[model samples]
Target chain A: AQSVTQPDIHITVSEGASLELRCNYSYGATPYLFWYVQSPGQGLQLLLKYFSGDTLVQGIKGFEAEFKRSQSSFNLRKPSVHWSDAAEYFCADYDSWGKLQFGAGTQVVVTP
Target chain B: SAVISQKPSRDICQRGTSLTIQCQVDSQVTMMFWYRQQPGQSLTLIATANQGSEATYESGFVIDKFPISRPNLTFSTLTVSNMSPEDSSIYLCSVERQGRDGYTFGSGTRLTVV
Candidate 1:
């Protein structure tokens, strides 16, 4: 069985500040990882995904994540965040038949 | 990528009542999934809605409680039978696109069982 862990429950960052959300996973084989953002009263939107490819994967809204196999981590990063970026971010590990095992999520609050 | 449109975006039902959430996809997909998310939490896979077959549910979830229907490749419905306060959560529908690209999710149906 595979699982994901997000260390941060909530994080507050000022506008234009760099942000990083930590995510670690426990999987036996090469795992497929993904980041998704969810706003209040809304469904989730995929930010990015990592399969077998470059270590650094770029996503929409200027977000990026690096897959570090040794660290078993795929941390999400953004150079500058806007208030609109404030939401709950989740990291998911793909299961057989492409099911997802999601983390508890990290709530991001952008302060002006 | 596939686009999902889920209906009954939100509803409040009495205990023991049932609510069926519908999901329609723009394109045919091989896998359709249902998930549950409690307030301020992550998503837990409820089941895989396979076309013309019985849905495969995850651990801690049973078919009797969360009955799913996939009449075709692009449409599915999840019914929360015998609802309870514990069943109050956001139910989301998703479809796998291109196997490895990513899963596209619907806006979610928020169910509050009082």
Candidate 2:
């Protein structure tokens, strides 16, 4: 079975600082990768996705992720962090059956 | 993108009771997925509801525990049966976007079993 792993359980970043969230998957081939954000008391929102073509994918809310097949990783990065960005981030992979497998998630805390 | 309306945004229930969550999609879809999110945890798929057929349950989930109904293409329901405090979690419904490889999810139903 395919699985997603998010090594970081929590990350604290100062406002306006750079942020990065790591995600790795265990699959023989490159699966459909995705990044989602969940605000406190909210549902999951699609940040971006990568199926094929460009390695760099841009998503809503000024978020971007890089798909590196060699490392089996799709890490999300933001140039600058905002207080609103403080939330839970989940990395997932879609299977052939179109079901999604999500990582444990990383809680991001933005500080002043 | 598709819009989903999920009812009973939240509810507090006593143990051994049951609560049903409904999800209605704006457009017709082939599959509607049900998921559970424990507090401070990631989402776990419960089952896949297909129109006019029995829902496919994931491992560790049974039809008796999460009986689903997909009477049509645009609507489906998931009932959390014999609820316990362990069943206290957010239940969400999702549908893959038509003509795309994306998915749209409902706002989720927050359930608290005491």
Candidate 3:
């Protein structure tokens, strides 16, 4: 019932170009959102989290995400993606009962 | 944020065998959790490992198949019993951060079942 959806399965961005990954959540109450990145054959690293207050949350590695409650979306954005930023991104939503549900994930490929 | 040290970074085991993964947190946490990530799939909650109580498993996950133990506030273990090829996955341990912090995860253990 409570889940996040990532419409984009894969995205290719120029090495220095801006990148945006969309995430939409379906939950009744206020949602706790988070963004995570995973490299190939590595564990997941938390990018940022949005519990309350700030609509725009900044994260590590020059990444940020804006939580749009009206749209039920928390999308991740980066000004200029580097080669090292090429990895899979996941959007997660925590429900009222403390259950965290993750989206399908988006794989971004940075090209020069 | 709490740091988690997970054991058996990678392992290959034959079918019908079992493997146990351990997670040790740097600081004591109120809530600890386990997750499973199948190849090319997102994470699925396996169970919630709370200290001094039996682990609460999610739908489709049973204690007999995936037993969990939380001996204390900073330690936990998950055992995949009677493993099959389908059980091969990357298992991760997570700790709930206090206040605004969402959660902290471990490096994860990559398991391969032959």
Candidate 3: C-alpha lDDT: 0.91
DockQ ranking of the models: 1, 3, 2
**How big is the positional error of residue B44 in model 1, measured in Å on the Cα after superposition?**
0.4
Clash count per candidate: 0, 0, 0
Candidate 3 chain B worst ten-residue window by lDDT: B96-105
Predicted candidate 2 versus true structure: per-residue lDDT over B4-94, tens digit per residue: 9998899999999999999999998899999999998899999999998899999999999999999999999999999999999999999
- Candidate 1 ranges beyond 4 A from true positions: none
Where does model 2 exceed 4 Å of error? none
Q: What are the runs in model 3 whose C-alpha is more than 4 Å off?
A: none
Tens digit of per-residue lDDT, candidate 3, span B33-98: 899999988999999999999999998999999999999999999999999999989999999878
Question: What clash count does candidate 2 reach?
Answer: 0
* Poorest 10 consecutive residues by lDDT, candidate 2 chain A: A25-34
- What level of docking quality does candidate 3 show? medium
Q: Give each prediction's DockQ, rounded to 2 decimals.
A: 0.87, 0.70, 0.72
| TM-score for the A chain of candidate 2 | 0.96
| Pairs in clash, predicted candidate 1 | none
**Per-residue alpha-carbon lDDT of candidate 2 for residues A1-112, written as tens digits (9 for 90 to 100):** 6778999999999999999999998874657888999998888898999888999999998899999988999999999999999999999887666688799999999999
Candidate 2 clashes between residue pairs 3 or more apart in a chain or in different chains: none
Residue-wise C-alpha lDDT for candidate 1, range A24-68, written one tens digit per residue: 999648798999999888888999999877999999999999999
